[model samples]
Target: MQKPALDIHEIPSPGKWFLLSIQHLFAMFGSTVLVPFLTGLDPAIALITSGIGTLTFILITKGQMPSYLGSSFAFIAPIIAAKASGGPGAAMMGAFLAGLVYSIVAIIIKRLGSGWIMKLLPSVVVGPVIMVIGLGLAATAVNMAMNDADGKYSLTNFSVALVTLAITITFSIFGRGFFSIIPVLLGIIGGYAFAYTQGLVDFQKVIDAKWFAVPDFTIPFLTYTPGISWTIILLMVPVAVVTISEHIGHQIVLGNVINRDLFQKPGLHRSLLGDGVATMLASLLGGPPSVTYGENIGVLAITRAYSVYLFVGSAVMAIVFGFVGKISALISTIPTPVMGGVSILLFGIIASSGLRTMIDDKIDFGEKRNLVIASVILVLGIGGAVIHIGQSFQVEGMALSAIIGVLLNLVLPEAKKGE
Candidate 1:
């Protein structure tokens, strides 16, 4: 069968470009800012990182594909882990290094070929790992929405939370295509509208907030170290591996959409470097680490418009918004339940992506080695097991699970001849 011709030249007219850009912006808006909001980082900083990251990605890709880079959900668990162990700063440091990990992987792919990187993190491993990243946080989302910070569940908050979550889930499952992607946004609007009706929203801050102000940027204080926990760093490093693989997938999708060989021409290495630079820059500015956003991929898929300059426009818009304190405050007023509703779906989709990866790769479940690897990874990662080397250094949870799985796969003597 002949391959379907790629739609590479469907450029939008000037009027359409504005509408499409608005669509792309709305597509990524909710989840993009939620990362920092959840982690207690500045939402404006997230905006800046996302905008700046998108611009950097365009530069690296030589303005070939139209996509927006945003804050990644993958780093959410690690940021929480780091914050629990050390503080936001320590997690930011580790995540900043995670960006470098992407650069290193890019170099490896460039030197050894993408196939080598693929073999290193096959579907059998990545699938379960991604699932763990999502499912692991299931309860946390619920707790945050319904319960207080101290873990005590509140009847009032829980009720609103459930309603918001139901609305988001319903929209995602039964809504149309574009609606599916923006369920989070819609949920937030719905929840916010309800909250406003009930007089729960405090517009005082928004009124007090200036129309334009600079984002409060801060440097990571190295002195506030969480006592140098090697375990935490080690655990986070493995997650970076999965994200690198995801990065490759994002690039391929972009290339397919734009009808260009991005990995070969501007090269995956440069794109990865762009991500690394953006991430490091974000950390320095008190923002969460950055990654290539899948949300924007949906935008490209729908619009079929490929122009790096448009993303440049988006980046400029983000920077302008970053300086607007009132805007940030308004975004903050989006109730916790609203965010929870959207997160429930977003996190689940992340898990499903991992499953899709395994199925797409045709992973052999009958193989003993594969089964052992998959089973052990899921149990260790989600079961909340911890491994401590000493008082100061401890590897537990996903980090420990990932390391152990890798080791077992590498040295288990070929699974005893298929059991």
Candidate 2:
């Protein structure tokens, strides 16, 4: 018997729908704004990119499943590394290429099935790599919260920072209902309120800022000075491989939650294309590359309102806020300690995701070969290992770690039978 046709428009009451949309918005709020804040991109543009990306995802997925696409945290380290080595524009170029990488992988998945892609990125390799990605940036997030971009200690009130961090941690660990999902937002609010009491906030920026303004979109321009570092490009490309796996995993989770095979229906190809296009769009507009947000999955589990229209409402709200310069200023003004406090949990969650990936796959951890591969990748990646073969030729850090992992897997002999 054919399953009853699911109703895409069967939304709950109008009031409930709006409330649920707000829940999703809050779930995605902290990380979305935090991306541009860290990368030195216009926060308004990040908002626009996220809004546009989410909308594109919905349309491409044919409204079959509900999810939100937002600014990716994985790109933060890469962007910073690129800016230090090249410039901000170079980082954008690398990110743009990364989007293209996603497209190519998507096409490959379409042709060969996702199993082939999974073989290249098994749980052991991906798990440690992702954990390293988070732990690698742990110090940076803490440092930023206490100091300004200039490295000066603007946060004279260390107590406030501590309080902010405490609030975020407390709420994240023990808070109930929607509050738990929004610990970062609450922490920000708590920190900002404390800052206001202490006269730390500069209201002039908020007052002087225009109520409505266009997003400050910038185009990527090629430069010969840095001369297109192949090392940087190659380093960033494989990161996309991990993100693509995340995309597929998210799709599967959402499919089960909503009781629809989104991968086969709207087709995984189209969803991948949509994500690629959105990331390219974000990169062109001077924002970090975009990715499907997993936090929205938490929202889905909580609300149990699997309607796509709620996501549509979120997209509309985010776009409307994107045009508001004052709102961007307010978000930009969030105190660092609060962000630091929040990052304590957020970054940990990122690392935990890697662990979950490994656990979910039921990786054969006892296998000597698998154990060796995972250990080497984790240590090399997190230890800041570098390889230099003369002046102009070198590979280092996560790039080197990823390449070494892949080579080790291919070259190493397979596990013996009945070992």
Candidate 3:
């Protein structure tokens, strides 16, 4: 489905472009930085790498797909697991392999066309996969909000988180026009102010930071202690399969918003390849993997500005900020509970989007097949079911749930509407 074409000129004025680009930057900043904060990677590196990745994506996709690439939440579990056993090097290896999987899939799509993706992961499968991505993180969000970083419950932090969350929701529901698209930023500010008032914020880091400094870059493969582990790589590679569904969904939504068939234009293979290569590059630099940012999509949906230049400008801005250590330090001072507050809302929106996908597609829950697929997926994903395979391998959470949903959808026969 497509809407009417945008008519505010192919390029906005320089001033407008800068303002819009800043909006895009803010839209993506929260999730991008959060990935590193959660995974213990350098937030500075993540920002720079994501900026570079977004630019690479644009160049490879021929500036056709107007999306920003930012840190992915999908790799949080896998990266954390790898870090536990083999540290950040192992996590980088895992993320690197995941990027390779995306590239491989892109190659396959280039040869085979995109129809098979639909047959394999229909709405019945994708809807639950998305839901799992959101629900699976619910506990983490709650924990961060209610408990201190050391796992001790803190009433102070919880109260701060509540304030942030309430303000975010209020803005999302009642704010109009462009402001409506920035609930995350508003929430963070509102929460930050409250935390600062309570003396939770430490401004020394920000004060000590230089206005401009080089990002601390690391090459994971070169610095790995015990070398790369094939097991870790293989374990993380399958994550791309889940993210591919999200990639497709994002393109569909963006296409709908801008009234353009982006998938048909640049083609999903190009988009996949671009994102894959971007993620690969980012991982090699010890930064979190990148994905199409939903926040930026919200910006696009409201502004109705699909110009590729806007994203380019935003990427450049992000890269500039990445070099400014002061900015990173300031963002870091946002406090855990404040982030937790925003995350609860952000994560819930992710789950709701999945529901919206199913609803918009008119997926019939009356069918036993649909019911079973969704039910099993929800339980396995949200209930924390893990499947062990052999002595050295296991699958659980979103990845496990996604694979199971796809298989079930493929095996089950579609019921006739009247039958």
Candidate number of the best TM-score: 3
**Residue 344 deviation, candidate 1, in Å?**
1.7
lDDT of 2: 0.77
In candidate 3, what are the lDDT values of residues 37-100, reduced to their tens digit? 8778889899899999999999999887889999988787678877887788778778877888
Clashes of each: 2, 0, 1
For model 3, state the Cα shift of residue 340 in Å.
1.0
- Superposition TM-score, candidate 1 onto the true structure: 0.90
**What is the alpha-carbon lDDT of model 3 when measured against the actual structure?**
0.84
Model 2 agreement with the true structure over 213-328: per-residue lDDT tens digits:
88667675532232357766865676786677678888888777666788788878878877887888887777788888878877776666778888888888888888998998
Residue-level lDDT tens digits of model 1 in 143-258: 76777446687766666666777777787789786787677778788777775765557888898888888776756554344334575577566678667767878888888766
In order, the Cα lDDT scores of the candidates are 0.75, 0.77, 0.84
Comparing 2 and 3 by lDDT, which wins? 3
TM-score of 2: 0.91
Instruction: By TM-score, rank the candidates, best first.
Output: 3, 2, 1
Runs of candidate 3 with Cα error greater than 4 angstroms are 1-9, 225-231
Looking at model 3, which ten-residue stretch has the lowest summed lDDT?
1-10
